[model samples]
Target chain A: MEKIVLKNVCKIFGDHPQKALKLLKEGKDKDEIQAKTGSVVGVNQASFEVKEGEIVVVMGLSGSGKSTLVRCINRLFEPTSGEIFVDGQDVTKLSREELRQFRQQKFGMVFQNFALFPHRTVIHNVEFGLEIQKSDLSVRREKAEKALELVGLKGWGEKFPSELSGGMQQRVGLARALAMDPDILLMDEAFSALDPLIRRDMQDELIEMQQSMRKTIVFISHDLDEALKLGDRIVLMKDGAVVQIGTPEDILMNPSNEYVAKFVEEVDITKVLTAETIMKKSQDVAYLTSDGPRAAMRKMKNNAIASLFVLDKQNKLHGVVFADEVAKLIEKGEKSLESAIHRDAAAVSPDTPASELFAVMQSISHPVAVVDENNKLKGIIVKGLLMAAIAERGGNI
Target chain B: MSFELPRLPLGDGIEAVLDFLVHNLAFATKAFSAVADQGIRLMETAMMAVHPIIMIFILTALVFYLTRQRGVTIFTFLGMGLIWNLGLWSATVSTLSLVLVATLIAISIGIPIGIFCALNGYAYKIVRPILDFMQTLPAFVYLIPAIPFFGLGRVAAIFATVIFSMPPAIRFTTLGIKQVPKELVECADAFGADRWQKLFKIQLPLAKTTIMGGVNQTIMLALSMVVIAAMIGARGLGGEVWRAIQRLQPGAGFEAGIGIVIVAIILDRVLQKLSKS
Candidate 1:
């Protein structure tokens, strides 16, 4: 089931009478509201769903409505017109008490500013949601302790929010959210306020936690690299509207628009894509056996091969040896098969995109090959395959 | 250096000044009584409007207890008793009663007005000048108009005191409410806090220090008007001082002035402590 859903949500602010008149006059479009009252449309007919256990990163620059969109999901700001459902429950229609219960039971929010209650201690801050939920004191405390331990702040319960560094404070905020055992976590630039070094550390910690807990998270950030690293799927927003929504791999390989293309162009795609895209396919009829220097040379000449894949007796790929490498080995009078071969080679699976393989090959200055699940050589995907893909798409190199 | 006439003896000079003050007091009293009689009913009405002193005492005690400060508790007790012991106890109580009544009235009137002004810039523009005028005008200036309407005694005294004391309370309350962090307000709203909840819980609690500051200023200004109000037969330490001066007794006048100073200090300290608490 979808964990959260927002249908046609929009938020506008101004005088009530004027707003009502404008709404009536301007009809349903956000432009009409803006034209009438000069009010900002914070979220403009936003519609999306977060599936269970999926990490959806909402990415936008400042004032792009990404923050506003996430806030609207929890009804932090009432959407001007729309409906929101959390776990199939219509949350937008909830009363105050019901909303509080919804927040306590289903939603956990972390703010960019940390928003740790200044008057509360670390453990007390973490336990704030539970306290608001009116859980038993001992049970809340116990839960808070576990949350603190989970966030790696186990021994710092007594310290006030001011006593901790920025990153530590954010961890306390994370622990606070975690203490509620929320179904969905909303993180609004939770790591952006920290120093770069600390941000990296927190990101690693978040990834580790996500691997274990598998909670649905809607993370908001402007940093492209952060989005690339943490997002299972990313929704890029601009001016209160979604520009693109796709997996990080999809975004990196094929950005939806020029804006997205420009955004992706600035990122180093080589480090992002794995070694599974460029591995070669093996020939079914032919197999590599113990062949002498002349035999190997004759095999290379006859096949018009630039490089040959090295495989074990079990047909598992060991590596590859270029023609020059074999020739060098022969020139050096190396007789052993092992001594004649170069085992270190770049290989990727069939699922890896041509764009990623191209990037990896460009970085390494070599042709890469495709491989299968059992580490057997599949087929070679050289610089030509990438060139052909890009050429076919009529895209710039 | 310039040449000058010989100075009078210190004792003789003192006696002469004392004589002048007494002459002025005797004349002022006759005028004060004439004003007092015109509104005797109003004075009684004003007295009837006085707040229960028990409430003030309880509040002071509660604040002191909460703070758990020995110095503050002692000051609260001493302040309450000193106002009673100064022979102007009944008059002081009457003035206090009127001031408290006026202040309560001011709060009811001021808070909403302040909130309105804060929310609407146009309203702020309209109210700002009136606040300025109310704050700047001399305390006695209010007496001229108040006397014509409420007449003399506690009623006029309260009218004048409220007029003088209210501006600070309203101005500061507006400022306090306006100055609440926007993000915190947003957070509260996001958590589904409606207008009323936001005002009472988030805005008011956060604005506590500034609002209390306004309260402190109002109480001090009200206390300051006690002496001026006494000239119109709003009896208090001011009347005691007026009588001592009329009888040409420097010792009596000095003691009464000292008593007024003590009351001022005690009230100031108590309010200051309350604000902190």
Candidate 2:
């Protein structure tokens, strides 16, 4: 089910919005409309849909109207024309009172600058949305406390926002939004104001939280890497119009225009290309329960490989067996492959980024093993394949 | 003779408007002034009934409680003691009472108008020029119409003082609320705060120091009006100063003026301390 859908939404800011809107409809672009009618187009016919429990990132530079586009969904900017549907309800048609109620009940928003109330204690700031919703004091306090705990600020609730560091302040901001327990979260550059290291930590924390919470999120960001890391599907916007909306891989592989290609040109490839994307499927593996050292050695010789991965009968990875070790085992007449297997091979989960694999690959000459969560052998990542995979994905090695 | 420009009846027009207000609104103004007069008198009597030494001790205690500043507390104690020593205690009390009532009225009326102006552009558009006129017009000019409506007493003086002092409170309040960061306002709106909630919870709390600064200015402006207010029989330090000037007692005039300065400093300091916390 779609959580949010914006159709032909437009937001023109000026004394005469209708005039600019009319000019926009007549095929005038943002600058032309602005010049012709003295009205700035904030968002121009933006259309997109966010599915349930998905993080749809709206990515753009400043003045691209990504922020405006997000705000319009909640009726903050009030779309000049067109429909906004959230859970099948027309948000644009809601009256002011209805809209307020809808926002109070459904949407939780987080801001870039950590707009925590300075006068309020961390818990009180978190409880702000509940207070507006007219929840009983005790009930709101409980929820606020739980939210503070969720954001890893469990006992810092009594402290004022000013008392905390920048990172902690934004944690309080996230707590404030989470305390509302709303279905959809609209995060407008929520971590952009933090230091780079703290920003990455926040991104990881948000991803961790999303795994369990699964709230549909529309995250707006100026940073391409952030969008790629956090978004299930990324919406690329330019000059108040959505240029492209697709999965991160789809975007990197097939940019719809020169602008998008330029926008994503400088992204760090190692961070994006995962071990699963970089690893090749294993051709052959010796079963520890069935195959002896001689069979493993023959398979390695036939495949023109120095080593072979040994798995148990259930296809769970045992370890890698080198040709020389197998030959030694064969000379000693060892029946079980376990005697020949080197159990200390480095293994990475399928989702591990290629950047982490570089360190693992550097310390060892053997291909790195990619395994499933159950330790089932999935594939192997060779040193040459890692660079080749990244280059194949349109990244400079 | 050279060509003559047509004479504008601006002053005459103002006089006519004042005349109309005096005729139509006298009963209402009189009723309001009577209530205000009673309140001011009650406060004055309560303060005057206390011994000067006792009042000094109480005020020093208050200053200490508000500021937690040893220096300010000592200043309050010594300042009040000096006023008592100079036989200016009663005059100081009277001036303080007049200022208190005038500031109360100014803030009560001014703050709402300021908030209204902040929220409504049309109202601000109408009120802005009027505020300018009220602020820039000579403080003494208010006394002319004030006498007809409030009838020459502390009430009339208070009327003039409120008019003189109220502009900063309104201007600063509007500025403070307007200066509340756009992001904070958006945050409040995002959280589903209504107009009243947003104003009270977000805008007002954020704008507090600025608004308090305005109130401080209002109090100081009220104190500045005391001598001018004394011209209409509103007795206080101003009345003492007026008497000394007439009798050519420059020493007495300076003592009363210094007394006013002491009161202004104490009030300003206390307010600043309070706002910071």
Candidate 3:
């Protein structure tokens, strides 16, 4: 199910938005149209959909309207034109009261600066939304307590926002939002105010939480790595227009335009690329159920490999056999390839990030066998292929 | 040739307007003065009903208990004792009555108008300059216009005192509410708080200390009007001072003035403590 859908949404910020929007639809660029109409284009005809239980990150440089786009989703900034549908209801048509109620019920937002009410105690801040929903005092308190605990602030309820550190205050903000249990979580640069290490921890924690809760979250970020780390799909924006929308790999490997290519220029590819993107198919590789060592020897020679990984018919990894071991086995008239197979074999999974492959490759001189969860040998990661992948992406720096 | 610019008849215009209102709405004026007369008599009689000696001890104990400042309590005790021993106790009580009534009424009127102006842009635009004019006007000038509405008496004095004192109350409340952080206001809106909920729960509470400052100013400004108010048939330390001035008795005038100062100081300290707490 699509949780959110925006069709030709445009937010023109000025007194005469209708006039500016008309010029925008005439194919005029933001600068040109803005100069002519005296109106700044906040978001220009942007369109995208967020799937249920998926994290969609809208990412860009400063002034890219990434922040504005997220605010538009919750109607914090009403779009000058276009339709926004959430759970099949067009939010643009909602009246002022209904819109406010919609925001309270369906959307929970975390801000860039941690916008916690400084005057309120941490628990009161968490209970604010619950209280607005008219949950009685005791119930609100219990829910607030649990929400704070979920954010790892278990017992600091009585303290004010001013008493907590920047990161903890943001956690309180997250807790405040979470207390309401809204269907969609809107995080607007939620971790950007924190120190770098704390920011990374917050990103990881958010990812971990998403794994269990499976919330549909719309996150805005200017940092590419953060977008890649937490987003299932990214909507890359530029000058209030969506330049591209794709998965992390799709964005990194096949940037659709020069602008998108420039955006990916400084991306740390090893951190983004996975084993699946680089692994080679293993259809003709050696297996334990196959004939004698001669068959393995012929397969190794044909593939120009000194060794071959052996797998059972069920596709589970049996072991590996080097050309020397197979040749020795053949001289001894060994019939089954099983006896020649080395019990211990270096292996990696298809999802193993490319950055970690170098150390694993350094630990073992042989190509790494990529295995699935059932110990099935799905593919192999050669050291040379990993190096070539790094070299190819290195120019982006 | 010297060509002179024509002077505006702004003063005449106001005087004419006041005359018209005094003529047309004398009934409202009488009704208001009656209420003020009743309120002042009630407060003064209550204070007088409590013996002066008892009032002094109560005030000192209150200062000590609320503020917990030994120096302030000692100062208050000595000050009130000096005034009571100087035989100006009744005058001091009457002065306290007039100022307290005026300040109480000023706060009641100011806070709502300030809140109204804060929430409505047009109201603020209209009210801001009115407040500035009220504040900048010389205290003595209020008496001239005050006499027409509430004819000569303590009622007229309180009418003038409220006018002179109300500006800070309005200005400060507006400023205090404005000073509430926009981030907090946004959070309040996001949580589905209606206007009243946001005002009472979020904005008003956050702006409490600041609004108290306005209350402080209102009380102080009203106290400043004691002597000025006495000129308009108002009784109190101002009346005592006025009588002494008329009789050419500097010694009595100075004592009455000191008595007024004592009341002002006690009121200021107590109010300051209440707000801080």
Which prediction has the highest TM-score against the true structure?
2
Rank the candidate models, highest TM-score first.
Answer: 2, 3, 1
Fnat of each prediction? 0.21, 0.84, 0.45
What is the number of backbone collisions in each predicted candidate, taken in the order shown? 20, 0, 1
Residue-wise C-alpha lDDT for candidate 3, range B1-277, written one tens digit per residue: 9999999999899989999998999887888777778888898899899888899899889889999999899999999999989988888888888988888888999999989888888999999888889888888999988887877888889999998999888888888999898877877776667788889888999889999989998999999896778999887889999999899999999988888877888888888988886
Candidate 2 residues lying further than 4 Å off, grouped into runs, are B1-7, B247-252
Q: lDDT by residue for model 3 over A1-397, one digit each (tens)?
A: 9999999999999989999999999989999988988999999999999999999999999999998888788777889999999999999999988987898899888988888877789999999998888889999999999999989999999999999999999999999999999889999899999999999999989988888878899999999999999999999999999999999878988899999998898887888878877888744667666557899889888888888888778888878888998899999997888777777888888888888887888887578888998988888888888877778877332
**Taking the tens digit of each residue's C-alpha lDDT, what string does model 1 give over A1-397?**
6888888777666655347434643554556666766777776667888899999999988988999899888878777777888889887899877887677677888889987766558997787677666689999999999999999999999999999999999999899889889879999999999999999999999999998999999999999989988998999987677878899878878888988888887775544544444333443212356765555666778878666666767767776666776787788887645665656778777666555666567765446657678876667666765665555444566
Native-to-model Cα distance after best TM-score fit, residue B134 in candidate 2, in Å: 1.4
Cα lDDT tens digits, model 1, B34-95, are 54443444544554454536534664686476666777667756665655554545555555
- Preferred candidate (TM-score higher): 2 or 3: 2
Once superposed on the true structure, which residue ranges of model 3 sit more than 4 Å away at CA? A281-350, A369-378, A394-397, B1-12, B23-35, B274-277
Predicted complexes: DockQ each: 0.17, 0.82, 0.56
RMSD of model 2, in Å? 2.0
The numbered model that scores best in DockQ is 2
Please, what are the lDDT tens digits per residue for candidate 2 over residues B1-277? 7999999999899889989998999787877798679878988899988898998998899899999999999999999999999999888888989999889989999999999999988988998899899888888888888888788888889888989999999998999999998999998898889999999999998898999999999998999886788999788999999899899999999999899889888999998988777
Fnat measured on candidate 3: 0.45
